[model samples]
Target chain A: MIKRLTYGLVALLLLAAGPLSHAQETHTLRLAQTWGPNTPILAETVQHMADMAETMSDGRLQIRIDPANKHKAPFGIFDLVRNGQYDMGHTASYYYKGSIPNAMFFTTVPFGMIAPEQYAWFYHGEGMELMRKVYEPFGLLSFPGGNTGNQMGGWFRKEINAVEDLDGLKMRIPGFAGEVMAELGVAVTNIPPGELYTSLERGTIDAVEWVGPALDFNMGFHQIANYYYSGWQEPGAEVQFLISQKSWEKLPPDLQEILRVAMRTAAYDMYIQSTHSSGEAWSRMKDDYPDVTHRTFPAEVIEALRAATDKRLKEVAEGDPLAQEIISSQRNYLKQVRQWTNISDKAYLDSVAGE
Target chain B: MIKRLTYGLVALLLLAAGPLSHAQETHTLRLAQTWGPNTPILAETVQHMADMAETMSDGRLQIRIDPANKHKAPFGIFDLVRNGQYDMGHTASYYYKGSIPNAMFFTTVPFGMIAPEQYAWFYHGEGMELMRKVYEPFGLLSFPGGNTGNQMGGWFRKEINAVEDLDGLKMRIPGFAGEVMAELGVAVTNIPPGELYTSLERGTIDAVEWVGPALDFNMGFHQIANYYYSGWQEPGAEVQFLISQKSWEKLPPDLQEILRVAMRTAAYDMYIQSTHSSGEAWSRMKDDYPDVTHRTFPAEVIEALRAATDKRLKEVAEGDPLAQEIISSQRNYLKQVRQWTNISDKAYLDSVAGE
Candidate 1:
């Protein structure tokens, strides 16, 4: 069976060789993402764009995706596309905040817009336009890639029983969570794996807030910590598609359209996914960890958190006018997305949690 | 200038709106990875994939990459892709040895082929086909990724000045390197990030090979350890892209063509990226730690090390016929690529390292 598969692959590869440059001449492009198939919000939607572009162009233009990290790393992707390393990249704009602080707003915030809110902000508000401005400096262009509806509070250890627990409590956090945690008196640490386990076992850190359980299970974090928290810190975290300016400019107009629609699809799917699988992972954990307690922060802690989050956000915006503009736009959008979520998301979670 | 960049971004978004989906049709695809933009391997490649898919299909095919821990943690990446949670993912084939022993043949070995040769084996040999077969059981399709060129033996607190030093030393390691370390009489500890520093600081681990200087510099390994070593245990480490079978079938034929070519481009670019930056990072480290010492394992140690590496390779082939098939094909292709490199890479490194 292995041999047969190998032979088939070889044939596929050989057959692949003939269409290389010819496809390029016809403006047919393929984008390879080095990530999980499910992470994108509307992955299927992106795929549809390719079909649309081809039909619209009457088969003159083509776009397809190799979802596997068949080619590059998620972060290195933007530069690759920019340098013509590859034609384009899908990434989190927030990750590039080191280079462009403003780009973070486009993706999500510690206390920013939820999915519907973020989408509205980007579309109707000036969010998308401002985001593009952030990209041009890097010779890149971008669009919203993925979004989780409203996330959990984050996995925790001991209990965040009080705001005092955060003090000197080393936690694995990223982006705005790290910022907000500082306000709450947490010693925020960015501990990538290959190092996380040793630290926790040896008492190097107290806690970490990674994604929902569909992800946490494999990380084997449950083995180390006695507690796992929700994704509350990042209520709605969005991913992004980073496109190289040179590459984006090279594409004919119709090809660009295909790319946009595809992103929208990924966004919608991602929201639906986080809602479904995250619950399953959490349920599994509950059964697995009879001794491990899962508790929501007290209403007081939550209220305090909300206040701290707002303060840190203000500080970030104060750094520049554009950031201020983004913050205001985000607030307006979230105010709207939350109303719908109260019925759609909260109702469902309340019904399920009760059961 | 930054303000203007934002303005330019607004313009692009406005232009993008012209070809909007208008609720009629959309294509969104998920691209997932095990790491962030900082991880030269998975991060960079994922971004490129998203771009390729977007541009090729116009706006019809959009790819959104889930960054490290955005949806799941690192180890979960493979399973997520396998179970179809992610449409695509970046995988370290060998990392899944517990589940698929044959998978190791596709990635780095304790003393496996260095980068150029490894690339030759996978691309020109039957290596790619064999790897696909290994992945087929999990409903995954794959593409070659770049190699982490000959890695440093490790960052050591005490030099391996002799074989005696190898005894009783606890080491931080992953993959085949751990296997080799165990065979070498060292106590291999698979400690993740949070624990590494405390371990090293407390003298629990005498040595570790986290990565090259670029990342090591940030981790501040220099503050704890004094010696930096050569690249031998992992001559060239390979990382790969994984896609769901269902997702792969969803692409149109022309888009598939685009994916194949784009992967080749991504794989080709990864070579220099994973290595060259290290040189610059090391140079910077020198300024930071002028007293830091650089050394290589002694001649006798290197020979024994090489012997162990060769032994591990033989064991892989002997223990599994599938691995044997892969090795034989990889070796043959390597012999051919070596001919061309003999005048370039081989000759250059041979003369310089010898000095």
Candidate 2:
């Protein structure tokens, strides 16, 4: 009878241990990313976020990531997360502008604040509140997923010396920058990523504007196009993380904080990684093909581009109160912040540029 | 007999639950910070790190922070953590230059890579490895704690047009930069932080070097000295988080990652915060003090300062192989990275400056 009692007591202790071990229940989140499997920087960011979340939660919280190939919709991340097909997503916010016009601003705008400045706006200024207001209605949360640093203005076969040079310039510049270029009389075309190299090589396109040297080197745009112009459009292009409100609400407080901090760190780390990779790639490009020269649009050409950008931005902000609010807030913030930038980093850079 | 058996079973179950529930143990680390209590961004970063650690660990891992006032060893954070008096510390590595000369390079160097570039070096390049080598002998682990963006060159009472202007210039500039200045015939003196403004105002010092606008604005330097020169010294100054090896080994793998990611996010967040606050403060300074102007030292002055800095660095690297490795790595990395910077953000900023 004593032996029988001991066996029963041991079984009871095991049962009690299960409940006591985890005061909070475990949860698993499904994350859909815009990039394909093993895409550098962007895909790495998603994985980094997942690793941090899992490790911090001690496997109590798990992230099941579905890349673009699995989801079969690279640009459908926002919709997927919002509809609960996935608990979260990693994509650029601007890709969803068809459904939400204001989403584009969060990704980047022509002549927008650079990475650090944009981050400041999002965190310390009206950016977060405004971003929340945009995403809240859709029952989705948007976060800065990662940054690609300052993108290079596409690779050009010919140098643009004057505003007139833009006329009849066949380029594969997409989104709002394409609209601005169109306003300046450039023939802006959108080509599939796979066909870009062939098109540029075959004289099907005069210029191809992809990402910076890091991502661009893989596309082989430099071999055909020698003049690499610096970027004005999407100066600080930031990708985003989108989470379903349902998924967020289901998380325990600790898991919620873990996910939040994980995404934040991943985003910042990507920016640093981009900076490192771009530096290495650009250096390699210069060494491998010294003919690939860096150029900036002349003052006249820049003036025209800026004018077109301003006109387009104003047109977009016309009847949309929320859009106007965000635009004005960003503009005002940029005005104040750029002055500081000019006196600080820019001035310092200028002073040391000669060396 | 049944009642006594039931009581004994309950006691046994409770005893089993206690050990089984915590397969991973709880640990609380004591952190000593160089900043005093409530030291704005610096103090907030420490608290932010601790909060993230506690929340992510679900109270399993905790950090108890002690500010400088409580510890009375602001400059001795290295020694404190090394001796295991504090499990961790948040302090500038350069502050302990007298004891460990290599520690200063991890912080910032004169005309070094800016925040993003420096972060890239730390994470992607040889920075972490070199830093580990420096601290491993001391039996401590160091991580990047926070960044102060690009520090500004101090406020000067008059314009500096030529190299001769620095001769006999009584300035309150400390650290390696002070050594560099002294090489250029500047009478460099270290003043207590509290006395800097009065010293500048009363002509005890010709110039006062503080942090950038965010921290410097509060010191009332803008009211007295009008010329705020751009910084070449201590660009991208990063504070460090030091963990005692003893304390580090006590935590589980999950907690270690939690602590690491927390510190990284805090460091990046601090940089963004500094950018935001500096913009706000500089704007306020302009509005409140119309006479406060921004200036850059002329090419001759910059050249002289650069030469002096080079000479000093060479001297520092002369005998120490480790120091030479670090210095060479930084110089090479800066060369490659700065080229990318010139083409991207710098070019963009220059083009868009007029607008």
Q: Which numbered prediction scores highest in lDDT against the true structure? A: 2
Q: Candidate 1, which CAPRI tier?
A: incorrect
What are the RMSDs of all candidates, in order?
26.1, 2.3
> Candidate 2, residues B1-355: lDDT per residue as tens digits?
8668878988988787766556446799999999999898999999999999899887888899999999999999999999989999999999999999989999999999999999999999999999999999999999999999999999999999999999999999999999999999999998899998889999999998889999997899999999999999978999999999889998888898899999999999999999999999999999999999999999998898899999999998888999999999999999999999999999999999986
> What DockQ would you assign to candidate 2?
0.65
Clashing pairs in 2: none
TM-score of each: 0.48, 0.97
Sequence-dependent TM-score of model 2: 0.97
Model 2 Cα shift for residue A89 (angstroms): 0.6
On the 0 to 100 scale, the lDDT of residue A116 in model 2 is: 96
Off by over 4 Å in 2: A1-21, B1-24
Off by over 4 Å in 1: A1-355, B1-25, B36-41, B349-355
**How do the residues B1-355 of candidate 1 rate in per-residue lDDT, one tens digit apiece?**
5456556545554444433323113457687777875665457766765666556555556777787768756767778888878888876777788788888777765544555456545644466788888888888887776555556667899877787788888898777777776777889988878788888989988888886664576778887788877656655677787878898788766455555544544554454444434544565676778876777677666666667766887876786777887777765554444332332222222222211
Measured against the true two-chain complex, the DockQ scores of the candidates, in the order shown, are 0.01, 0.65
